[model samples]
Target: MVSGKRIADVGYKLFSGSMMLLTVYGGYLCVLRAQRYMQKQKQLQLAAQNESTASETIKD
Candidate 1:
């Protein structure tokens, strides 16, 4: 027969484990978003550079 204390301990462990999993998952999502943001910024910078070069040629 399981005692109430044992049941409570099991519940606590399960809750803590789930929280840890969520924290890791959240970190993963953050990393993915940051990577996407960085990539987009890089693309924008390249586009601006190209545009400036194109304008310079037009002016020449």
Candidate 2:
């Protein structure tokens, strides 16, 4: 029969490794999605500003 200590140690290592991998992958995906969203937002903001500027210029 295996000792309780050995089982606990193995479980700890397994959980720790899985958690580390999950965190790394999660962080990478978050960064990728955030960048895409920010880029889209920036494009929308610039387009709106340009439209406003164009309207003002036409009135002058």
Candidate 3:
């Protein structure tokens, strides 16, 4: 039969491991969101530049 202390230790380790995994997963999601936001900002800037150039050409 397993001792109570050993059982408690195993339970604690499992909980800690799961929490670590969740933290890592959360960080990965955060990085992906930031990357997407940066990409969107770049596209918006490019679109704005294109529009301005188009307008200038029309004026000319």
Clashing pairs in 1: none
Q: TM-score each candidate.
A: 0.97, 0.70, 0.96
Please give the range of 10 consecutive residues that has the lowest summed lDDT in model 1.
Answer: 1-10
Candidate 1: residue 20 Cα off by (Å): 0.1
Tens digit per residue, CA lDDT, model 3, 1-60: 999999999999999999999999999999999999999999999999999999999999
- Alpha-carbon shift of residue 25 in model 1 (angstroms): 0.2
Which candidate number would show the highest TM-score if scored against the true structure? 1
Can you tell me which runs of candidate 1 are displaced by over 4 Å?
none
Candidate 3 ranges with C-alpha deviation above 4 Å = none
Global lDDT scores for all candidate models: 1.00, 1.00, 1.00
RMSD to the true structure for each prediction, in A, is 0.4, 2.0, 0.5
Query: lDDT of candidate 3 vs native?
Result: 1.00
**Which regions of candidate 2 deviate over 4 angstroms?**
1-7
Q: Quote model 1's TM-score.
A: 0.97
Q: In terms of TM-score, which candidate is stronger, 1 or 3?
A: 1
Clashing pairs in 2: none
lDDT for model 2 comes to 1.00
